[model samples]
Target: MGEWIQSIADTYKAICAGEAPWVALGNFMNAWYDYAKDQREALVSESLPALATSSLEQRRWAAFCVASVEYLCQRYGLHCPDWVYQSQYSLVEPWFHAVNPHKPQVRARLIETTPEPFTRRNIYCGNKMFANKYEFAAQAGTTSPNQAI
Candidate 1:
């Protein structure tokens, strides 16, 4: 896990240093995929800064990073802290769905700092859903049950 994170961090450094497109993107995506396979939640959270920095007109890659994080959070029962999600919206909005609706913080500074009226809801609730899903799975004793995660 440490090695994987180091590779990702190195990729971020390369991107910051203006590395070539293929090397930077390939390294980032490779590291991200490995982390996802390992179900490393903290690394997933930690990767956000690098991902935000590494998003260089590669909108699809940016979206990939976001979706990967969301999926891992769901898989591993890791809820992003609210403040962290708050920070990321300044970079880009995460993925969305019908059940989750945007919520704008009413604090004066929050409103002043962000002109956008809303941020994605459930930004931190994915892990709770994951845990519930796990518990349900445990109860069912099989993976085929009809349930939401």
Candidate 2:
């Protein structure tokens, strides 16, 4: 897990440095898809305990890694055609977490400004959005019809 996270962080750093985000996203996505079934299960069944117990920094890094990859994937129009993300979609949360971090205002703007392919409709906001209407609802008070705060 540490290695995977490190690899992801490195990838994000590379992307931030303007070094072909698609290449990193592709490599990371390939690794993820290789073990996605196990990872999907671990996200809910096993790894979550560790993730939950991890320091906020650790969790934050994890979230950043996930978000970076997902964002790059979307930016490059890469989709997880094989990874269904069926295990409660826990992996999806990090994308939002990475985007929002601690600022709800930015989170809201980022969520609202996100393009169609990256919007809540496509990603379901990890079920964070309560209803379809609230998905696009102005980010107010954390919880909206489309998402749960």
lDDT (C-alpha, whole model) for all candidates: 0.42, 0.41
The per-residue C-alpha lDDT of model 2 at residue 116 equals 41
Model 2 TM-score, all chains together: 0.30
Q: Over the stretch 72-101, how does candidate 1's per-residue lDDT look in tens digits? A: 455557784333344443334443322333
Model 1 misplacement above 4 A = 4-11, 47-68, 71-78, 81-84, 91-149
Task: Name every residue pair that clashes in candidate 1.
Answer: none
Least accurate 10 contiguous residues by lDDT in model 2: 40-49
Instruction: Score candidate 2 by lDDT.
Output: 0.41
Off by over 4 Å in 2: 1-6, 9-53, 79-107, 114-149
Candidate 2 lDDT over 1-149, as tens digits, reads: 53452245455555554566557555555444443423422322221122334544344343444544445455444553323222322333434433444588766665665444344223313322212233334545444534543
